[model samples]
Structures are given as structure tokens and as C-alpha cells.
Target: MTSTATHLTLNRTGDKQPISGFGLWKVPKESAADTVVNVLKAGYRLLDNAADYGNEKEVGDGIVRAIKEGVVKREEIFVTSKLWNTNHAKEHVRPAFERTLKDLQCDYLDLYLIHFPISLKYVDPAVRYPPEWYYDGKGPNCTLENITIRETWEAMEELVDSGLVKNIGISNFNAALIQDLLKYARIKPAVLQIEHHPYLVQQDLIDYVQKNDIAVTGYSSFGAQSYIELGVDHAIKCPPLVQHDVITAISKKHNVTPAQVLLRWATQRNIAVIPKSNNPERLASNRDVFSFNLSADEIKSISALENGHRFNDPGFFFDIPIYA
Candidate 1:
């Protein structure tokens, strides 16, 4: 009578929060919603949408409908949204948050993250991709005054105090950048969401976050194979997880999809993953990962897939000099 994945376990965060869900990016902006709450009913407790994704109202609508239908309670969901680049100025943080809250139809969020370590100059939101002094058709300005990373981070801390956000996290930041934040942040960051997949696995970073008790969420677990459709040319055509000799052998041994194996690999290591698939069958299969665990040898074989390459390097963002 076990209805959930037996081996899957939720991790505790600030103030004793437990999360076992994945984030949703690329949710469609159109009318037909599959329901964010039904996703909850399917055991997804995390919805990771952002302003850049342009579907906050629909995401919020889905969640609300699910609640009204008696599918799940608001407290059971670990909702998250990020502050977009254009809003990096200290003065704009709250307004941006309020916009997100309004779109999400929620009073507070479980996690709010600084979308990137970089920043863009302030420009009117009315204009699409406002041309700024840094827009040499090149990249981010990263000027000390254009909106310092610390400035945005400090305000993020304020959100937690004001009870607008429960936990704080950072994405698109490297180890050095992460450590630098530790010097000034009063409320330590609780999670690090990164572009993780078998091919570009980051062990040292993962170990560092784990050593410090900061949770890690893996985005793009299937690798760049998924983003090629989005015009990212360098995205890897990941070795079919179900077909890779290592993954296939193990899946056969365990009677699970290569996906279950991939997820199980992360969950067993205390890493969190947010894999998305709108298809009901795929969603169910993706959620079916918690029943069993990978063997030590299976784990090592999967770990061996890493070769220190990053397919989603945000290099197109190279025109943005901040990371440079």
C-alpha cells in the first residue's frame, strides 16, 4: 500500500522545512493549464518558475485550482521564483518581488533566489530588452554601481526577515563567488541550484555545498539534449540514458528506466533534482523513482560519465562581461 517512492526522502531546510518536489521552468504562457496543483497531486511539491519564464499567473492559477479542488494544501508546496536581471537595483527588489507575489497569488514564497551572480543596468520595464550603456550588443556591464551582487543579496536577506520569503538561494554562481557571499550574508544560503547532468557533473562543488549543509538542486538532469530545441546549438545529445551501457545495464538489473536511475543517483547522494515533462506518462515515470536505490558499482559507473564539460555555459551570455 505504499503510494510514494519508498527510497525517496525529503530534506530539511531553514526552520525545519521538508521538500521532495522539483521545479517547473518553461511552463507555457498560453491559456490551457495542466494545473500546478494537479502536479502537486502527482506528488510534485516544488514549482520553480521565474519572471523570465513569463508564466507566473498560469503557474499561480494551476496551484490555486489544485488547492480549491482539494488536491493539496498551500503549506505542502515549496514554491520558488527568482529576481530577474533587469531588477538587480536595490530599489527594485521589493517591487519585483511584489509583482511575482501578485502573479503567484501567494503572500510568501518558500524560496527566492538571485537568478544570476551578474547584473544589468536599470532601464524601464516597459521597453523590451532595454538598450543600456552596457549593451554594446556585447554582454553584461558588471560595473560596481550597475547593481552590485551584494546589494541584491542584502535585500534578499531582508525578504526573509519581512516574512516574504522563507529561504534564500543562488543560481549560476561558481564556487569562488559562492564563498565570497558567505563573508557578508547574515542568513546563510540554503540551496544551490545548478545545471547538473551526468555529462557535466560537478563533484567538488557538490561536496563543498554538502559539507556546508547547503542543499543542491539539479536542473537539466537530462543534459542539453532538451534545450537543443530552444536554439542552444551546443547542447549535448546525451547518450540515451536508457541505452548507455552503464545506465542500461543497471536499469535492467533494477527493472527501472534510465531516468529513475539518474534521479535515484542524485537522491541517494542527498542532491535534489527538478526534471520537467508535461506528458502525464513521462511525469508519472519520472515520479516513480523513489522505490529502490542504486548499487555502489552502479553509482560509480554513472559517476564515471563526467568529463568536466558544461553544455549550458551561458556563453551566449558571453556578450555580458560580468562573468568575464
Candidate 2:
């Protein structure tokens, strides 16, 4: 079931990234391997993963099985992973990447990203891997490291120099930080991944990065779906994108699911999307977004749903308010 999905050409390496990919954010380690295999069989070539996901090992197992069974070749898949916030210091960057590469069982990553701009104190992998938010893995207290982005980015460039990562980019970065990064970045960022749904359009940031030739990848395309499972108040209180009147109307008009309409709303505008689902039917529908086109008025109607709402703010769960 190979897909004729659209591709976005990256900057330095000219690598073509799939416009629609599978995100492995909250996937449990127990089911990660099976899920990865299924998605690959369903025609997902781009796998968006991270050390923070705590399921890379299982995800890698799936990839290995998929390749061994001839579901898809390694080169046919564009594997992407991220550097966790705890591994932002210069000395920790390569070692952290090495661990991820080992876990994924890959020689090199198609795209590697600094998961977030916020730097946290390093937690040894032996102490606790994928150290999320809290320094000790148990607390209301979170510590910040003094490491600058420039230092971490320099180390990222070294990964490129070593030919381990084909392209390096940032996630959850704003325009100002991007401007600063460009001033000193020897290897320009090839992509920018952000929480972009109709509720959080972020059109200005998208326009700015796209103008610079940095492709954009949108995660959480369904808005409140992922966060509602985590008991987030903002997400719980917000309207479900799949059920929203506008989305439903558009979906009916296009004869597609609301999920497909939401994804198409982004991909139609040239922004990439990483949407995950365990249901086999939904998986195929999600990747089939490029088949239809939304009218100019429908796109505007979807964008009109923006209310500056953001569901993935670290501030909501931790002391660090990166968005604030």
C-alpha cells in the first residue's frame, strides 16, 4: 500500500520529507512495536519519534521487523527523532543522539530536532532515561540549566559534520528564537515542527519560517484530542475539533471524516502534519489527505476558528513556561 503522498524538499541536504507522517507521542511502549509495523504497512513512510516518547526501543523493533519482512526498506522511510530537553548541553548532545540511534537501530537519522527550546539540567541516562520535566523523575520542582541554545546548536552542527544526522531543526520555537538561531547557525534548520491546529493557526510564524525555506510540520492536528487524555483542563474545556460545526460541515461537504478535513486544512496550505491513530481505518484516512482540495472559502473558514488557543504548553504541566 505505498502512498503517492506529497513531499517537502529540505534546505541543505535537499532531502524530501513526507508531508504527512505518523506521530508516536503518547504511544505506550507495550504496543509501540506493533503500532509502528501497522503504520508502515498502511503506507506511512515518515515516523516522528523522540526519546521523550519512552517508546523508541519498541518503535525500533517494529521498524526492524517491517524492514526484515519487506514491508518497507529503511531508506524508503524518513525517520525523525528529537533531543530531549534534559540533553541540551554541548557535551550531552552527541551521546544523547547516539542513545536514540541505538534505540532506533538506525545508522543515521533523516531529521533530528531539538525537542524544545527550553534547556533543563542534564539527567544521566543511567539515572533516568527520557527525563521529562522534573529533574529527579518525581516532583513538583523542575530545574533549569544555564546552557545556552547556541552551545547546544553548535553541538548539533557537529552531528551533521560527523554525518550522523542528515538535517537538524527546532521544535516549538517562535520567530524571535528562529531569527537568533539563523544569525549563528552554520547549518540552517530544514524544518520547524509545531502544535498547529485550526485553533492555534500560528499563521505569522508559519509564514515567516516558510519564507526562509524551512519546512513546517504540524503535530496534534486534531487540537484537543491528545491533551484531553492527559486530563488537561484547557484541552478538556476546549471544543473538540472533530466535532466542531465548521469541521463537520466541511467534512460532510467533502465526504471525508472530520479528522481528514482537519488534516487537509493544514496540508492543503503546504504545512506538513503528523497525526497518529490506533484504528486501522483512521490510519488510512489520515494518510489519504492529499487526494482532495479545500476551497478558498473553506480554508478561510477553518482558519477563522483560530482563537490563539494552545494545548501543548509546557507551562500547564511544569514550572517552565516556554510559551509564556
Candidate 3:
């Protein structure tokens, strides 16, 4: 078997693999045809889009074009999509993934995720609460009465059996929720995608995932640099990774850019990373990770930058009782 996954490694999720290339959530939704093609040409074998990104069609087009030009084989690409917040109902899970596949024009997903552990009412693409926020207690939106996290987990497990998704994972889930899921989950979550960076290293959570033998994936590894346009101005300015004395010295020492150091920091720690870059040149730089290795002490210096802040906090959606 060629191993349908693009990233060349596996974790204990029974059958899960990581994809490197690019994560395309924050890119301008109406990116030009040439822009996407350029990204693929730059060597990003993964395209991370979601039903919520509202740009799966564009991503799919890029993939088709890249294949047409012989940039890479369809199997050589690792395509991942996520079920939106509104479609967390057990019955709605597969249907939602189907829509994503339809838009992305793919036969099956390398990996599919529940998007978040919290569920809410099924909101459509054209809605005010675009992110799928809702207050109903008994619906997908309300974590109170309608659909519970465990219910959503069971549905995700069903997807794997159906073959719509190669593997399943969770995003934005905390340690407590992850621990609780282990008690009832028929299939353990293969990956826990969380926001990580020098500013928010999340040591305890990473340790727990490793102990459970789950492959961990890091998102937003550059902290708020990517979020500046998404209303994270604070993350945009505070404690810039480029300004870090250690990062600067290392960049000069290795004659590499600071962003490369940032990405390598996570990979060196044995965690998966999905950094997004729409710029063709930057995309190439991002995937240039395997070219250089970071030293042990330098990795520690960068890893020590955790200040206990979380970027993609979902407190407005699901309220875990542990906070009490």
C-alpha cells in the first residue's frame, strides 16, 4: 500500500498520519487561481480547509490544477477537512463531511475532525453566526441539553467505519475533555489539534496526549502573527518571535529566518505542525523544515516561552465544568 497519507509518519490513533504542506484557513477567501497554484508549486502537499473556511472549492481547484500540471499525484497529496460546529449531531456528521468532500472534489479525506468537541444547532453556510455559535441548550449550539461532546465523539467514530474519513481527531479540546473522552470513546482520537507557539507551549496537555499515545498536532505555531487580521492585534504585537533574543541569535547562527526556527521548534519536540502561508515564497520556506535541525538547548530556550495564554479559546461556545 502507498499509504494514503502525505506526511510520512504515524501516531497511535489506530490509523492516523500528519500532513505538512499548508493549512489554508486564514488565506483570503477569494484568492486568485494563480495564487493557489503557486502555493502548490511551492511544495505544500496538504491543504487544510473546512466547511467553515468557505473556500474548499478554491482549494479543490488548486489541487486539480496541480495534478493536471503533474505537480503531484492525487494520492501524494494529504487533504484534510473538518465538520462544522453546527453539524455535530450524530446523523448530520457524515452528511456534513460529504458536503466538504463534494466541495473539495475528493473521494475520501486523509483525516476528518469534529472541528470542536462542543456541538450546536446546525447552522448553514449563509448565516450571521458564521462560526456556528448558538445558545439553545438542547441543540447542537447548546452544550446544555441537546448534543453532548460524547455524542459528537461517537458520531466521529462512525465516520471511520464508513470510510468517508481515513481517521478522525478533535480540535480545540482541553486536557480534561480529552481525558473524559478516553472513558467512553470506542475509538481514541488520533490527533488533538491545539493552538501552540513560543507564547503558549501547553506542556501538561502535550504530556498527557503523549502518555495516551495520541499524535499531537500544533496549529498557529507562530503565535498571533497569523491572527493579526482575525482580530488578534494583541498577539500580533506582544512578544514577537522575531524579537526573541534566542530566536534572533539562532537565526543568525544558522543563517535561517526566524519563522523557520519557529516551525522547526515544534517538529523537533516530536509534535506535528500545520502552519499556514498563502505567499508562495513563504510557503516554500515553511516546508523547508527538514533542511535544518535545531539543537537541544535551543529547542529548550524556544520551548520555555510558554506564558499560559491560549489563542483559539472556545469559552464562548462550550463551557467545561472543570472551570468551576
Candidate of highest TM-score: 2
- Residue-by-residue lDDT tens digits, candidate 3, 158-253: 888887777778887889888899999988877777888988898888889878877777888778776566665466567777678888899888
Which digits, one per residue and each the tens of the lDDT, describe model 2 over residues 122-151?
A: 999888888888887888888988999999
Which segments of model 3 are wrong by more than 4 Å?
1-8, 11-19, 32-35, 125-131, 134-145, 316-324
lDDT of 1 at 241: 51
Each candidate structure's TM-score, on Cα atoms with residue i matched to residue i, is 0.87, 0.97, 0.87
TM-score of 3: 0.87
lDDT of 2 at 67: 96
Evaluate all candidate structures by whole-model CA lDDT and list the values in order. Answer: 0.71, 0.92, 0.72
Q: Of the pair 2 and 3, which is ahead by lDDT?
A: 2
